[model samples]
Target: MATLQLSGVCKSFGTTPVLHDIDLDIGEGEFVVFVGPSGCGKSTLLRLICGLDTIDSGTLTIDGEIVNDVPPAKRGIAMVFQSYALYPHMSVASNMGYALRLAGTPKAEIERRVEAAANVLRLGPLLKRKPRQLSGGQRQRVAIGRAIVREPNVFLFDEPLSNLDAALRVDMRAEIAALKQRLGTTMIYVTHDQIEAMTLADRIVVMNAGRIEQVGSPLELYRRPANRVVARFIGSPRMNLLPGALVGDPAAAEIGVRPEHVRLAGVGHGLAGTVRMVEHLGSDLFAHVEIAGVEERVVARLDGGREVHVGEAVSISVDADTSHRFDAQGKRMAPAHNDRRTA
Candidate 1:
């Protein structure tokens, strides 16, 4: 519905900088996710966009117009926070329609808009129930429904599913994904969960220590991280980093490999190690192998059916084509001519 852009955006609290030189372009109807560790300024950036916090410098634009001075209510954006923040005294319909009412909309129009949003969220049947009568997920739906009634140009979600249980988080994730498809509103979501960032975003903005690290599609960041920090932060079990000497690459400083790209091989064929730990996750097996010369443990993902045990001797083969090479400065190195096939 709208394009959001940030240029050299910076924010701070007192004298401590929270965001530094942040620049991003979010296209119309784009689901862009901001992901990083705690204290990484993800939420601060979201608040700046929502007008909850003012940017100390640079421009904030929505739909090609400067909105740095605009108030949150006038900025045409709706934020769904981690807390439901629904009024316990109000029924579902009243809570959802409250915003329209505050704007002096006619009672009939308020009812119409409320019912419309309820229908979309499947909250129609519970319109008359109080927030006290609802479950956690239902309350969250009410919160989302409240936002929907506003019909804003952009949606800002700040870890909206963090309060839910694991099962409900998954369910709510699917629901939010469906909501985005149905409305096609520009959305900027802030979360620390990489899985949510990977699955929900058209593009993920990876952040670290108040600075932008890399911005790309889920697979792009996973397959080719911009640097070592991103390489280690984006994956589960994390990528294994071996010294260039151990990887037989004298020109490189380190070689990185994802667990899934390494396979079990016969003894004396590849990097030999002792299986330090084995994790069976139904469909996949993750073996943390302790190599002789590598400082960090190397994890190899294999078939779950493979009977591997702790302390077992195993050889792990790295797919050179799939491996990532980094220079001494911790920057990703250009692949060798023959290794270009790894991508």
Candidate 2:
């Protein structure tokens, strides 16, 4: 495991800047996940760290050693890409130890490392099988085993499960979680999947438009986003935004209420709206209500067994204590001293 530091990091492609002045610190053996939409430069940052690409300007330190000039082979970092890229003709054992063999390692050492990695990944029984003979999940394990055999100081994963089906992704996610506990190595994962970021990361780094938006534990980002961008991105179904004027706060720009915090009330009780649609999941139900003045439909989470029908007229109320207020610039607004429940 290794600690990593990035100071004043900046990068660009020709005239377009891809990463701004970014600074971050990662502790030894910590799992940090980078999350952002496409074109947010998360992958570029990973490439810079792994020596696959040159940093435009910044200091990248690994275990107190500056490695800006280090080659990929000497960086003591192993990266698992989205594509397994396993050689079809080679057996699992040969594929796992390919890097060591290329570096002129002793045959005995390579075999020992391969065997150990296979055992840890539960791939020992399939060592003699070719890539074509294994399932997708098994092939991914082999890719992970390849990285494990190197015993690198840090591991980098760039959406390693993107190619798998939904069920395989979940199963692979569990295996990766178990791997983290078993190996206790520093890991940096990049993904657009919220569940992966929330479950696998010790802390999540949220990026947007070439800048670091927020870095915090999953719940921190979900409950107290630094800005509107983060507030809108962290949750599933997303937080519903209503104009502040509708809630007796004309001074504020908008109020954010999570779906779970929104209540469907009797007609004429609160904001009047029409239910546009209803979704029934196993444990929860969601209603999309279209208020007269609100531009977008507001989503409300209800108990699954509760009956709600599309086109039904309903009133909605937001819990003032749990709701959030934002200023015109999209910054969170503090609650008034006179009322803790009001923003």
Candidate 3:
């Protein structure tokens, strides 16, 4: 019952446009993550959905109602911000119950709801502790618990874990995932971290320059990116792009192969390159090489234990079946058609 739909959504900051012609549908009980580089308007889109910012033009609907003009507080959405935003002077229980109390809920009702949320968040033992006394993770839990007590139709998280350290971010990610399963409420989260998007989202909406580039399950986008920009964005080391001629394709403007897909082979059998640098991460090794005719360096991934020295001669194999072809306009080309031209 918490479905959200945005139709032709547009937003502007003064004269400059920030989001453009956005159209999306989020099903009830689905966890969707918005991911993009900073300044891409993902967080702005979240604000529009939460009613914190008004859209320049679009229809915003929740469930069956048009909520474009609804105030954030009345929109049946609760937002958890990047900052914990807990009141340092307030006890955890008080902070969680404050909203209900302000709404004139009976004291007993407030206590009941707060207790339920606290138990769900495992903050029962810390209910009497002030925010100042809590660790970063506990403060975040209190922030989430505050939203839980409101029982909104949708949960909107704007980089809620970005403030935490790496270890705490991983732990909180698991906690949030469990919360989603327990609540089964529609949740829209925004983050620039691809790992967070990949690990947590049921589906990820990849945005770029105020527009959505692609939307799909994590692996789908990772394996079959719609275009060049997406091909470069989703992966850690990113896909290695080379001129089509490097792969013996005359028609394709570019061909992309993931670092992991680039196999080190015997000399003269694959693309010739000299290793420029090697990054060893204990489990994996990434070798950066300068391939002939390739404008940018190509990176190849290997087992961590492999000893590859800088300036070593190496060749990388990229199979046709595994490579992605893009035309001059940066759009992905059909494999059959693309291969026919090469054949």
Candidate 4:
């Protein structure tokens, strides 16, 4: 295993800048995920680390060795791409051992490594099958097994589960998590899927427009986002942004509250609004409420069934301590007190 580090990394195509002063340190045996919308340069950063793309300006180190000019093969890293790039004619065993064979490893060693990878990935029964004969998930596993046989210091996965069906994606995710635990190898994954980042990463790097928005643990990003963009991006249904003048001292131009934090109140509640819509998600219900004076929509996540219905007048209340204040520029405002309540 190896620790990967990028310092002052910058990349551009022609005159168009894509990454700016990127700095990140990935610990040995840690799983770090890069997540962002398309065109955010998450994949570009990964390619740079894999040595597939040259860096414009920065230093990349792996296990204390500067490797900015190192070729992909010499970097001792393996990349599993979005597409399962398995040779159709080669059997699974041959496919997994092809790299070793090409490197002139002993035939016995190649066979042993191939068999071990097959057992680890549960591909023993399909060793003789070709890519055409395997399911999507199986083909992906073969691709991963091919990487494993190389015994790389670091593994890079670029949207490896994006091609699988929903059920297969979930199953493959669990399998990959278990595989990492068993192998204990450092891994860097790139994906736009927030759930994947939240569930699989030790720390997530949220990027936007070629720049990092925030870096934190899943729950940390969800609970205490550094900015408005991250606050909305990390949560399901997203957080509700309301336009309200500060009611007291240390007030900001706008306030942000999560759906779950907005509670239904009786007549004496803090904010009054008309329920616009309600979505029942089985375990929870989300309501879109329109505050009278504000044009922005406020959402509330209610536990169980709600007694309220659309078009009905409703009052919502938020614990003042839990609200996030934001300036006009969308930057976060620190809470006035440290004793803010949360549910």
Candidate 5:
């Protein structure tokens, strides 16, 4: 495993700057994920770490050694890309050992490493099968096994599961999680999917338009976002925002509440609105409410069995104590160092 540090990292393309003065530290054997929407530079940042691209102005150190000029092959890092990139003609064993073979590893050592990686990935039974004979998930595992054989100091994954279907994606996620436990190697993953980041990362680096927005553990980010961007992005249905005036807070521009926090208030108690729609999942029902002054529809999460219908008049209340207050500039304005917003 290796520790990675990026100080004042900046990158650009022609006249358009991508990554700003970014700084991050990754501990040895840590699983850090860079997550954000497309055009956010997550993939570019991964490429920079893999030495596929150069940092315009920054110091990238690995294991406390400055490797700004180090070649990718010498960086002790292995990267798995979105594409499987396996050779169709090569058997799984050959594909997994190809890098070692090219690196001039002895044939016997290559065989040993291949066996070890296959054992780790559970690909032993399929070693003789060509890429064409393997399933998509199996092919991806082979690609990962290819990297595992090298025993690199760090592993970098760039949206490796995005190409798979939803079910396969979930399966691959479990497999990758198991791989992390089995190897305990330093892994940096890049994904636009927040769920992937939340589930896979020890720390998630949230980015927006090439700049790092926030970095925190999954629950820390979900429960206490630093700004509106993170508050709206991290959640599955996203936190709902209403004009702070509704909460009688003149200093707050917006009052952010999660769907789960938007509870059903009694008649005329809170915002009087009509249910726009209701989405029933297994255990939760999300009701979309349209109010007079609110721009976007307010969505409230309730018990799935609750029989809410479209066009039904309802009153929904925002739990101020469970809500967040944001300044006009969208900065979180908690009352104290650790205090959340309260009525």
Candidate 6:
């Protein structure tokens, strides 16, 4: 395993700058994931670390050695791309051993390493099959196995599970998590999927428009987001943002509360609203309510089952202390004073 560090990393293609001055430190054996929307420089950041692209200005250190000018082949890193770049005619065993063969490794050594990686990835049963004969998930495993056979200092995965079906993606995600724990190598994964980042990373680096928005554990970003962009981006179904003026303090600006945090008021309750829509997800239900005075629609996640229907008048109340306050510029203010529920 190797520790990776980037200081003031900047990249640009002609006049358009894709990456700004970025600094990050990844410890040995740690799993760090970079997540962001497309054109956000996540992939470019990975390419910079792998030496596939040159940096305009910055320093990249791997295992305490400066490798800014090193060739990709000599960087001690292996990248698994989204598209499984496997050779169509080569069997799994041959593909896994191709890198070693090109490097002039002995036949016996190549077989030993290939067998080890195959065993780890559970590809031992499919060794004789070509890429055309494997399933999408299986082909991806082969791509990963090829990298494993190289015995790289760090593993770089760029949306390796994006091409799989939903079920296959879940299965492959578990496999990758298990593989990381077993190998314990430094890994950097890039993805646009927030769920993948939440489940797979020890810490997530949230990027936006060639810059980092926030870097924290999944729950931290969800619960105490630095701004409105992060609050909406981190959660499934997204957190509801209602347009409401602070009754007591004009300086408070806007209030933000999650759908799950909103409570249904019985009879004479809190804010009155007309139900716009209700979504039934079997175990949980979400109500989209339009408040009389507020312009934006508020969403409430009711526990158990649905209790209200469309066009019904209802009252909604949120634990004031549990809410988030955002300034006019969208920066998060002090958290509302409420008891936090444990996940």
Q: Which stretches of candidate 5 lie over 4 Å from their true place?
A: 336-343
Candidate 2 residue 52 C-alpha distance from true site, Å: 0.7
Q: What are the candidates' C-alpha RMSDs? A: 2.1, 1.7, 2.0, 2.4, 2.1, 3.0
Per-residue CA lDDT of model 2 for 183-219, tens digit only, reads 9999999999988999999999999988999999999
Which TM-score value belongs to model 2?
0.96
Question: Pairs clashing in candidate 5?
Answer: none
Which lDDT tens digits does candidate 3 get at residues 4-43? Answer: 9999999999999999999999999999999999999999
What local lDDT score does residue 272 receive in model 2, on the 0 to 100 scale? 86
Location of the lowest summed lDDT over 10 successive residues in candidate 6: 334-343
**What clash pairs does model 6 have?**
321-336, 321-337
Ten consecutive residues with minimal summed lDDT in candidate 4? 243-252
lDDT of each: 0.91, 0.91, 0.91, 0.87, 0.89, 0.87
What TM-score fits each model?
0.96, 0.96, 0.95, 0.93, 0.95, 0.93
Error of 6 at 264 (Å): 2.0
Per-residue lDDT over 1-343 for candidate 5, one digit per residue giving the tens place of the 0 to 100 score: 9999999999999989999999999999999999888999999999999999999998999999999899997899998989988888999999988888888999999999999999888999999999999888998999899889999999999999988999999999999998899889999999988899999999999999999999999999998899999899898888999887765666789888899998876568777889988899979999999977788998899998888888889888765578888999999997423333322
List the candidate 1 regions with Cα displacement exceeding 4 Å: 338-343
